[model samples]
Target: MRIKETIYKWIFTIFAFASLLFLVGIVVVLFKEGLPIFKHVKLVAFLFGKSWYPTYEPAEYGILPLIMGSVWVTVGAVLVSVPLGVGSALYLDELASYKQKAILKPIIEILASIPSIVFGFFGMVIVAPLIQRIFKLPVGLCALTASIILGVMAIPTICSLAEDALSYVPRSFREASFALGANRWQTLTKVVVPAAGSGVSTSIILGVSRIVGETMTVLMVSGGAAMIPVSFFQPVRPMTATIAAEMGEAAMGSAHYHALFAIGLILFLVTLVFNIIAELISRRFRIKLGLNR
Candidate 1:
C-alpha cells in the first residue's frame, strides 16, 4: 500500500510539473515573437491604430480592428449564452426530476463533446444561409453569425459547470429557505443562486476563455474581414481567426508573422486577467458561504 501510494504521488507531481512547463513554454514563445512588433510599429500604432492592411507595401500593423472584432464577437456570444446557460443550469440543478436530469445532463455533455470543426461546418452550412435568406444580405458569414455559433458552443460548458456548482450547495440551505415559507423559485433565486454565484462566475470566465481561443469556428463564420465591425450584421475578423487564416501564409520571421504572435499575446493576457479576477471572486464567494472556514 505504501509503495503504491508513493508511486501515485510521484505521478501526480510529475503531471503537475509538466502542465506548468507547458504553460511557461507557451508564454516564452509568445513573448519572444510578440516583442518585435515595437521595432517597426509604435506601440500605440499597433494597439490603437484602426487600419489592418498588412498586405500593403508599407505593411500597416494596426490591430484595433481585430481587437474590436474579437471583443464584439465575444460579447455578442456571451450576451446570447449567459442568461440561457445560467437558467438552464438552475433548472437542471434545483428543479429537474431525476429522470429528466438523467436525460438532460448527457445531452448537455454530448453537446460539449461534439468537435468544434463540426460546429463550424454546421454554422457555415445551416446558420449562415438562414441568416442570409432572412435578412436578404449579401452573405450571412458575419459577427452575428459567429456570435450565434459561439453562443451555442459555450452553452454546454456554462450549463454543466454552473449546474455542478449549484448542486454543491447544501440541502440544509434549501430546507431552511423552505421552512421560512419561501417557494421553490424564491429559494432558488435568493438562496441557492447566490450561494453558487462564484461557481457560475467561474463558468462565465471559462466560457470567455473558450470563446477567445476559438479559431476554426470563428474563421469559418466570421467572414475573415479585417475591419472594424460597425454592426453585428457586418463581417469582422476576430484575433483568433486572423491568426488561423494568416499564419499559414505569413512569411516566417516577417513583421506580419510577429504581429500575429502579438495578437495571440494580447488574447492570452486578457484571458489570464479574467481568470485571476474569477479566482479572487470565487474566494470571496466561498467566504460569504462560510465554506472558507
Candidate 2:
C-alpha cells in the first residue's frame, strides 16, 4: 500500500510538471514570435490604431478595431447568456420537477455537445435571416448575429456550473430562512443565491471566456469586416476571427505572421486574467461558505 501510494504521487507529480513545462514553452514561443511586431510598430499604435490592412500598400497594423469587435460581441453574448443561463439554473436547481429535470438537463447537455461549426451554420442559415428581417437590415451577417450565436453556445456551460453552485448551498440556510418566516422566494433570493454568488460569477466569467475566444462561429457570422463597430448591426472582425481567417495566408517570418502571434498573446493574457479572477472568486466563496478554512 505504501509503495503504491508513493508511485501514484510521483506519477501525478510528473504529469503536473509536464503540463507546466508545455505551458511555459508555449508562452516562450508566443513571445519570441510576437515580440518582433513591436519592433515594427509602437505598442500604443498597434493596440489603439483603428486600421488593420495587413496587405495594403505600406500595410497598416492597428488592432483596436479587432479588440473592440471582440468586446462588443462578448458584451452582447454576456447580455444574452447570463440572464437566461441563471434563470435556467434556478429552475433546474430550485423549481423544476424531477421529470422536467430529466428531460431538460439532458437536452441542455446535448446542446453543449453540438459542434461549433454546426452552430455557425445555424446562425448563418436561420438566425441571420431572421435578425435581418426583424431589424430591416441589408445584411444578416453582423455583430448581433455573431453575439446571439455565441451566447447560445455559452449557455450550457453557464447553466451547468451555476446549477452545481446552487446545489452546494447548504439545506440549513434555506431552513433557517424558513424558520425566520421568510417565504420561498425570499429564501431563494437572499439566502441560497447569495451563498452561491461566487459560483454563479465564476460561471459567467468562464462563459465570457468562451465567448471572447470563439473563432469559427464568429468568423462565419460576423461578416468578416475589420472595422470599428458602431452599431450591433455592423459587421466586425474579432481578433480570433482575424487570426483564423488570415494566419494561413500570412507569409512565414513576415510582420503579418508576427502580428497574428501578438494577437494570440493578447488573447491568451485576457483568458488568463479571466481564469485567475474566477479562481479568486471561487476561493473567496469557499472560504465564506466554510468549505475551506
Candidate 3:
C-alpha cells in the first residue's frame, strides 16, 4: 500500500510539474518572438496607434482598434450571457424539478461540446441574414453578431459552473432560513447567492475569458474589419481574429510576424491579469464565507 501510494504521488507530482513547465515554455517563447517588435515600433505606438495597415507603405501596427473591438464584443457577450446564464442556473438549481434538471443539464453540456466553428457557421449562415434583413444593415457580420454567438457559446459554461456553486450551499443554511419564516426567494437571494458568490464570480470570469480568447467564431462573424468601431452594428476585428487572419500571410522574421507575436503577448498578459483578479476575488469571498478554514 505504501509503495503504491508513493508511486501515485510521484506520478501526479511529475504531471503537475510538466504542466507548469509547458506553460512557462509557452510564455518564454511568446516573449522571445514578440519582444523583437519593440525594437522597430515603440510600445506606446504599437499599443495605442489607430491604424493597423500591416501591408501598407511603412506598415502601421496600432492595436487600439483591436483592443476596443475585443472589449466591445466581450462586453456585449457578457451583457447577453450573464443574465440568461444566471437565470438558467438559478432555475435549474432552485426551481426546477429533478426530472427537468436531468433533461436540461445534459442539453446544456451538449451545447458546450459543440465546436466554435459550428457556431461560426450558424452565425454566418442563419443569424447574419436575419439581422441584415431585420435591421436594414448592409451586412450582418459585425461586433453585435459576434457578441451574440460568443454569448451563446459562453452560456453553457457559466450556467453549469454557477449551478454547481449554488448547489454547494449547505442545506442547514436553507433549513435555518426556512425555520425563521423566510420565503424561498428571500433564502435564495440573501443567503444562497451570497454563500456561493465566489464560485459564481469565478464562473463569470471564466465565461468572459472564453469569449475574449475565442478566435474562429469571431473571425468568421466579426466582419474582419480592422477599424475602431463606434457601435455594435459596425464591423470590427478583434485581436484574436487579426492574429488568425494575418499570421499565415506575414513573412517569417518580418515586422508583421513579430507584431502578431506581440499582439499574442499582450493578449496573454491581459488574460493573466483577468485570472489574477478572479483569484483575488474568489479568495476574498472564501475568506468571508469561512470556507478558507
Candidate 4:
C-alpha cells in the first residue's frame, strides 16, 4: 500500500509539473517570436496607432482598431449573455423541478458541445440576414452579429458555473432567510446569491474570457474589416480574427508574422490578467463570507 501510494503521488506530481512547464514554454515562445516586432515598430505606436495596413507601402501594424473591435464585441456579448445565463442558472438552481432540470441541463451541455464553426455558419445564414432585414443595414456581418453568436456560445458556460455556485449555498442559509419571512425572490437575491457571490463573479469572468478568446466564430461573422468600429452595425475585425485570417499569408520570418505573434501575446496577457482578477475577486469574496478558513 505504501509503495502504491508513493507511485501515485509521484505520477500526479509529474503531471502537474509537466502542465506548468508547458505553460511556461508557451509564454517563452510567444515572447521570443513576438518581441522582434518591437525592434521595428515602437510598442506605443504598435499598440495605439489607428491603421493596420500590413501589406501597404510602409506596412503599418497598429492594433488599436483590433483591440476596440474585440472590446466592442466582448462587451456586447457580456451584456446579452449575463442576464440570460444568470437568470437561467437561478431558475435551474431554485425554481425548476427535478425533471425540468434533468432535461434542460443536458440540452445546455449540448449547446456547449456544438462546434463554434456551426455557430458562425448559423450567424452567416440565419442571424445575419435577419439583422440586415430588420435593421436595414447594408450588411449583417458586423460586431453585432459576432456579439450575438459569441453570446450564445458563452451562455452554457455561464449557466453551468453559476448554477453550480448557487447550488453550493448552504441549505441553512435558505432556511434562515425563509424563517425571517423572506419570500423566495428575496431569499434568493439577498441571501443565497451573496453566499455564493465569489463563484458567481468567477462565472461571469470566465464567461467574458470565453467571449474574448473565441476566434473562429468571430472570424467568420465579424466582417473581417480591420477598422475601428464606430457602431454595432459597422463591420470590424478583432485581434483573434486578424491573426486567424492573416497569419497564413504572412511570411514566416517577416514583420507581419512577428506582428501577428505580438497580437497573440497581447491576447494571452489580457486573458491571463482577467483570470487572475477573477481568482483575486473569488478569494476576496470567500474571505469576506468566512468561507476561506
lDDT of 3 at 63: 92
Would you estimate the TM-scores of all the predictions? 0.92, 0.94, 0.92, 0.93
Writing each residue's lDDT as its tens digit, candidate 4 over 64-157 gives: 9999999999999998899999999999999999999999988887787888899999999999999999999999999999999999889999
Candidate 3 per-residue lDDT, tens place, 107-196, comes to: 998888889999999999999888889899999999999999999999999999888878878899999999999999999999999888
Number of backbone-clashing residue pairs for each candidate, in the order shown: 0, 0, 0, 0
By TM-score, who's the top model here? 2
Best by lDDT: 2
Q: Tell me the lDDT of model 2 at 253.
A: 98
RMSD of each: 2.7, 2.2, 2.5, 2.3
Residue 196 local lDDT, model 2: 99
Worst 10 residues of 4 by lDDT: 284-293
Runs in model 2 lying further than 4 Å from the true structure = 1-16
**Comparison by TM-score, 3 against 4, better one:** 4
After superposing candidate 3 on the true structure, give the runs of residues whose Cα lies further than 4 Å from its correct spot.
1-19, 286-293
Total clashes in model 3, counting residue pairs 3 or more apart in sequence or in different chains: 0
* lDDT for residue 74 in candidate 1, whole number 0-100: 96
Query: Tens-digit lDDT track for model 2 on 1-293?
Result: 99999999999999999999998999999999999999889999999998999998899999999999999999999999999999999999889999999898888878878889999999999999999999999999999999999998999989988888888898999999999999999999999999999989998998899889999999999998999999999998999999999999999999999999999999999999999999899888888878885
- Model 1 is weakest, by summed lDDT over 10 consecutive residues, at 284-293
